[model samples]
Target: MNEPEAVDDLIADLPEWATTEEIADTMRVKPQTVLKWNKEYGLKTVAVGTRVRRYRKKDFREFLLRSAEATD
Candidate 1:
């Protein structure tokens, strides 16, 4: 598959609500980097409880697409 399709397929496999570790694993970054993205970039997350945060798969997909387009 082409790059975009491959990216889509990868994103499609993510859970509806992904954890910091899951996002980091998918992007091949550290979990701390994912948290940094949330702080610096526009990666949004939802707080589940006092100490749990979950990222929306759709938001992550959009972020990846935007980043790819920016590099091109």
Candidate 2:
């Protein structure tokens, strides 16, 4: 597969334990943008202690579903 296809596959198969940076890098968005989505969209997240935030792979899927629905 080409690089873009490999990236799509990687995102599709992402693990729940992956970090926000990993998601940001894969999606080509800023880390702050991802954090903003967590705050603004109520995207599912977990805290490692107090200050650190991590998003679930399921939330990413849900975001995609919501976006698709909105576009339709």
Candidate 3:
């Protein structure tokens, strides 16, 4: 399959709500990079309780798609 399709499949397999580590693992990046994306690239996050944050799979998918389109 093409790279985009493979990436979509990978994102589809992620849990509905994911942590920074999970996203970093799926994208083959360090967890720090995911946090940086949240701060720098408008990667959305949902606050869980008071001290935690989770990322929605759909948002991550959209972010990836947007990044891809921006580069092309």
Candidate 1 global lDDT: 0.84
Candidate closest to the true structure, highest TM-score: 3
Residue 23 error, candidate 1, Å = 0.7
Worst 10 residues of 1 by lDDT: 1-10
How well does candidate 3 match the true structure in TM-score terms? 0.81
Off by over 4 Å in 2: 1-10
Residues 43-70, candidate 1, lDDT per residue (tens digit)?
8999888779999998887787777666
TM-score of each: 0.80, 0.69, 0.81
| Candidate 3 clashing pairs, residues 3+ apart or interchain | none
Q: Taking the candidates one at a time, how many backbone clashes does each contain?
A: 0, 0, 0
Pitting candidate 2 against candidate 3, the one with the higher lDDT is 3
Q: Among these predicted structures, which one has the highest lDDT?
A: 3
Q: Residue-wise lDDT of candidate 3 within 1-72, one digit each (tens)? A: 226676689887789999988999998999999989899999999988976889999898878877766667
lDDT of 2 by residue, 1-72 (tens): 124444456577578765788778877899888788788876678899987777787676666556545546
- What overall lDDT goes with each candidate model? 0.84, 0.70, 0.86
Give the clashing pairs for model 2.
none
